[model samples]
Target chain A: MKILLSQSLMAYLSEPWPWYVSGGLIAIIMVLLLFSGKNFGVSATMRAGCSALGAGKINDFFHFDWKKAQGWNLLFIVGALIGGWIASTLLNDPEPLALGSRTAEHIKSLGLSLPKESKEIASGFLPAEFSKPEFVFSFKGILLMVLGGFFVGFGTRYAGGCTSGHAISGLSDLQPASLIAVIGFFIGGIAMTYFLLPLFYKQILFPLINELQNSFPK
Target chain B: MTKAEVISWYRIQEMFLFENFHMYGVIGTAVFLGLISVQLIKRFKAKDIDGNEIKFEPKVFSIPRYLFGGTIFGLGWAMTGACPGPMYTLVGHGYWSMLIVIAAALFGTFVYGIIRKKLPH
Candidate 1:
């Protein structure tokens, strides 16, 4: 029964429904946001919360107590993470996303070996290597996590919002800065993933993976 | 009733879950409509809370506040996959366990509110 279920589920994931449905739903949300007199900005919600915290009191972060503007925005941020996890695991849904064979080969060329038998790198279950708590807490892993956190925080602020805010909401509103920022974001992402990330992953993260694999019981 | 019963219940529940699954298209259309709606509202002379046009203005924006506030936002976003807009949608889709991130976000906000007095401009 599980086999039959998995097969049909795989077929469904291969369909284009995931992208179409999720994208449409977000568009509906964008319209709702404009109606509410609030702009859809993920980063601004954080600022409002911080200012409400009294950022303006000590160093002039919240000069007017922006807390009053705060409402249900933070709740949205929490939902996205939960949504992504559930989408990957519980739903067992196919995302219809796959790295092409050439791209797969390219990924292998970077020295991070992928499973040869895997039809598509994207569809595979989460790697067992990543499941270990020690891997998450290791020197390189922890540094990656923390540095990733800091860079995202600083970048979102510098760019005025994260990708979704600029790409979805700001673009919807035809905001010029959001356009430029969104372009910069994609450029940055491509550059990091293609060039800098590979070197870092191989030199820094790979050894950590090897060490953790040895320590853990397979 | 029991674990097995709960599993059965979930199976039954799946029958009701809308599986249109048109993820990207739905998101794109919704955003486009939302933008159009905002434009319509503004052009129709809709009175804002302050009776002004719904325009984006930089003069009224505080750079320092924006910078600091944005940092907190980016940090949370990086740690978690979802940002503001997607968060609620996730909840509506029944990812109830996400309440943890929501709680942390709220706590972060509450902490900032408490310290608003000591922060720099």
Candidate 2:
């Protein structure tokens, strides 16, 4: 009987929970944040960290009393990191991760190759072609990482939030700015996928890959 | 785990628009909306512990700034699958390379602080 119970528990942990379950949990957290008179966001934590590091002396933007206003946000991010560790390790799914067929086909259509086996797909969450040391150390990878990081950091601050802050929290509060920002996020995503991405792969990334291969002769 | 895999997910779902098409995203959004609505109602109609009316003012609204900021943010999101929040998650999941993005993002914020005075409201 004990063995059977253990098996069932393991099974439950191995499967992904239905969408509503996770969603409900997020809702509960948001309500708690609202009652506490705190805004929900991650980017604000960066500002708080900057202030804590004494960035306020140089600029008014980071000059606030971060301990009083954003202490909770700092704790919140720590909690998220801890929570993620627990989820990924303790409650990790035993089965291989799988992508939707349409997603895989679309990637292939973009001139990228995917591993055939389910186990390979699962372990290859970041494909080797891009995530491998050679690729990351290459000029193309460095540029993408640096440029992309700048855009995300600057953009989130300028916009006043990110996917979680604006789309989930701000939209929940029915803020007009969040709504506008969310729409902008969608348009930008579509443009990148259809326009910028293709051009990038064809002109820059592909050439880099070829050059690297030639230099190594592997 | 990798940037390419992350980008593929974006193509399938189109960022936060997943709420419009996926059950998980919708459920999450609905939950937030419900809770936020209740909070708004309480702020307007209910009293605090000391019988004082809660004064919750909405954030400042600026159309042009939001549009510009949001467009740039969207472009960034497209380039990187992990946002500020998920970047932490990625690190926790053992993708330490995400630290590069996080570092760069913080630097970007620092630059913004230096130049914010010059940007129009």
Q: What TM-score, over all chains together, does every model reach?
A: 0.58, 0.82
What DockQ, between 0 and 1, does each candidate earn? 0.14, 0.42
* Clash number for each model: 55, 1
Model 1 global lDDT (CA atoms, 0 to 1):
0.48
Model 2 stretches with alpha carbons more than 4 Å out: A1-3, A109-131, A208-218, B1-20, B23-28, B31-55
Q: Across residues B1-121, which tens digit of lDDT does each residue of candidate 1 receive? A: 0111111111111111222222224445655765776578667856555555566443223445444544444433433334444434334434342234444554444445455556643
Considering summed lDDT, which 10 consecutive residues are worst modelled in model 2 chain B? Answer: B1-10
The CAPRI category of model 2 is acceptable
Tell me model 2's lDDT, rounded to 2 decimals. 0.65
lDDT string, candidate 2, A126-200, tens digits: 344444566566665566566777777887888888866887777776778888877777777667666776678
**Tens digits of per-residue lDDT for model 1 on A27-73?**
66655555556666666666665566556675454465464565556
**Model 1: DockQ vs. true structure:** 0.14
lDDT of the candidates, in the order given: 0.48, 0.65
- In Å, residue A59's CA in model 1 sits off its true spot by 3.0
